[model samples]
Target: MPSWDNTPSGTMTAAALSLPGAQPPSKCFTIENYYPKPTLPSQKWVLIKVKAAGLNRAELRGRNGDQPAPPEFGMFVDEFHPDPPKVLGEEFVGIVEEAGSETKFGKGDMCTGFIYGGGKAFDGAYAEYVICPAQRCFRLPETSLSWDVLGAITMSMWTAYGSLFEAAQLAKGATALIHGATSSVGVWAVLLARDHGCTVIATTRKKDKVAKLKSIGADHVVLEDELKEQLKRLAPKGVDCLLELAGPDTIQTLALPNLAKYGSVVVTGVLTKQWSMKDFTPALIPPTRKMTFYSLEPGQEDIEGVESVIADVISRVESGTFRSEMFLDKTFPLERIGEAHGYMEENKAIGKVVVTVP
Candidate 1:
């Protein structure tokens, strides 16, 4: 068994970045080249032949010269880069080719986990094969879940699950006000909440998306701006839970007030603009409610529980209890990776987009 505390457990290959970032309008974009494969370890690691990987905003930020590789990733504070040369993608779904001795998983299993250890500590999933700790993956049903959806769903689905069940401690009869219902993660939250038999009020920006939210079993759908007023008339008492993916930037006019007692606001995204609530002190009349933000990073204590959640998601998706489309709105071959980042930056797609390994 490889020891995580004393030695390197997972094996890694020498990184080769072919295209790094966007190119001139006339020249087709591609990723840049980097060092050769650097061999690491696989003793306590699982080798995944990455079949598909999703395009996420964080990677987009790194690719677009916005997100810099942080200190923990081995780069000094002064020397980090976020161009196409940096390995991209944190989430991917693939078949495990081997397992670390310390881990319970074996080769040929399919799974995915959040990899926020930084672009340096963990190479991005846009590759032929890579390694991850055993705890980062979970087994999947033989006939269920497309690799694309499985890979894409894990992060969003887990966040939704953790936030609703663990973070919010929601009850069966609670009313969950879910913001950004059109988002991939937002829609998943609605499904998980509905699965618990909760009344979910889904909010979206486009009225055309109302039907989409309903198809996912939302009890009510309202425009983003109209969230508070519509719920005021619909639920009257205020929502018991608010699943916020838009972060702290969203306007507060739609605040949910129908919660019975000790309602909660769970924030996952940072779209709320400025976080000024720290300046305001709420009076103690609303039954001692709480506000919290969900960090998708799974903690050490949650290793096994997360695996259970992964199994549930895979089982449900395979059983038709959860029906999801390939979140891939677009794909760029490994060579055209630069262009892929550009597409995400352009904000053209609605669901999850991925860069397919050629």
Candidate 2:
């Protein structure tokens, strides 16, 4: 019989799983409940007994029927061998139930990595069981690493690290402007930039989020709509760097004439509102004036650099110094998955809304 455990750091990753007499694989959440069928064992795969997983906005895109199901073994199986519908999930921490022949992971190991999107392209952490590759799995430190905490940081940390180091190349004491300061990455960016000695000016559309942002160590938090006035208050010299999570829509805001000489803006969103700057002249806000559209896709431009820095971020998380409850405002049981999505859609959450798998 398939078995499970709830002790997050224990041998079992799943709080539940198939038993010998249990019915065939079937999904528990969402509109489409595909039955689980047999999945092929891979030379490079590991079976994770999921304990908990964190939610990201990317998963919402898939849930809205926008993206393809996560790359399952079936897709690769057709290219490699035949497999069945795989579970979908992204950021999760669980015990390794099985490891491939050449894997660095072993049975009973606790690890966390990107699950992609749960219930959409991938069978995410909403379920008790999940399968992944050893290469994609990053091990949790033996000490002080809690499952919930690990799940919380993987995605946000990766996004923040990639933007700060790879895209913005943030320098110590640089003046930074962060939009959506109350969001998970926004809060993290504020804290991280501070660690580097940067002075930050942040923004939020809702005024009530001010105290929350300040609690997380923000230098300043202003309403999103007040950019004109807020920009004045932040000093007319503009900023040395801007982190734009507001997406394509707000790109024009960074073009404000107030930006400092050679300032940079690193972006990672798809919102439709936008800002435009007309000066294309090399002498003016030149193309040499940097702008980066940050995406966390796993590839050569990021591959090694993203992993190493995330490892460092995880180390900080392990130490508890980098822990930010700012993103963990709400949580749901695996069954309340629908409500969780709705809560996020309402935009009522100040930080992160996570799902507990147990």
Candidate 3:
């Protein structure tokens, strides 16, 4: 088996949080070099030389101590240790530096995937190297897409795919409403829905992003305040599917009432930072409408299911059906991850903010 002895370093620098609270974004993180390079625990794992890692809201929640306790059925329970000084990142794209005998990946293959217990049970992609289960990783297609672009898309695209197709069963010719349309996942949802032949109506809080959203293939782009009025005009029968990414703030006020009689609302993201809805009741949902939640958590699906969804997304990108470059908002070096998190918290980014590892 290949070993870290062959690599350039015995230890690596990683962004870690020693304390979790509402501290300054930069203050919450520290670059540490004392941690030893992680070894593959078993043949089912691979060691990656990470080139780029994607920033996610979940990490921010972790830093703020806002993440809820793991569910009883959580698959990573055995590995999880949410103590301070944890590395924080969920998605990455990199070269397979070392692969186990049982895995299909080999040295030098480009790969991208999500880490379910990243920053907790396992060291995350915020470092120069990360260990991932072979089953959770996907080989990237031979394409011209940049590493940052690939990193940006992995988790966001996976979430969008699961919400649109797996959860909602969105069909061709359906009218889809993407709430929080300027978010990275929302952007991917817009593209996926449009590619699937749905008439997409995207909503954004900022008026400045309207043109950008429309250019990316949204049939209509409306401000959140104007959603109902515009939807009435554009999708009079109500939308066939609603992707609620803004979370509790918009779910009752905007998402539910605008759904078609038989529409499905898939809650895929919580851009608002509000975890629960105020006074939410069963009566909020109409009789014929359905509401569901989709997450890329472990145990949600099998390895084959994850591989299939990622492959479908990659195939679309390779075929030019989805423009990978259109989804990247910014790239920050690992040293500047705090600034990247700040940017995301400000809601200033139109798409994914990626952190590149040196």
Write one digit per residue (lDDT tens) for candidate 1, span 220-324: 999867766787687777788888777654424344344546888877755433434443445622557777766644343377677778787777777778776
Q: What is the TM-score of each candidate against the true structure?
A: 0.77, 0.76, 0.87
- Output the worst ten-in-a-row residue range by lDDT, candidate 2: 1-10
lDDT, residue 306, model 1:
77
Across 124-218, the per-residue lDDT of candidate 2 in tens digits comes to 56566676655567776564655666666766766776677678888888888887766667767877887788888888888888888787777
Candidate 1 residues lying further than 4 Å off, grouped into runs, are 1-35, 41-44, 68-85, 118-121, 251-260, 272-287, 296-301, 326-350
Model 1 Cα displacement at 320 (Å)?
Answer: 2.4
Backbone clashes in model 3, listed as residue pairs? 17-85
User: After superposition on all CA atoms, what RMSD does each candidate show versus the true structure?
Assistant: 5.2, 7.9, 4.1
Give lDDT: candidate 2, residue 166.
Answer: 70
Best by TM-score: 3
lDDT of 1: 0.63
Q: List the candidate numbers ranked by lDDT, top first.
A: 3, 1, 2
Q: In candidate 3, what are the lDDT values of residues 1-358, reduced to their tens digit? A: 2221123347888888766774568888888876567777778788999999988877777777765445311346554444522788877999999899999989999888677566555568899889887777888767677778788788888788889998999989999999988888999999889989999999998999999899889999999788778888998878999999888567787778888988999887776677677888988788899988887555556667766667677777778877766688999999888888888888888889999998
User: Candidate 1: lDDT of 100?
Assistant: 73
Please tell me which model should have the higher lDDT, number 1 or number 3: 3
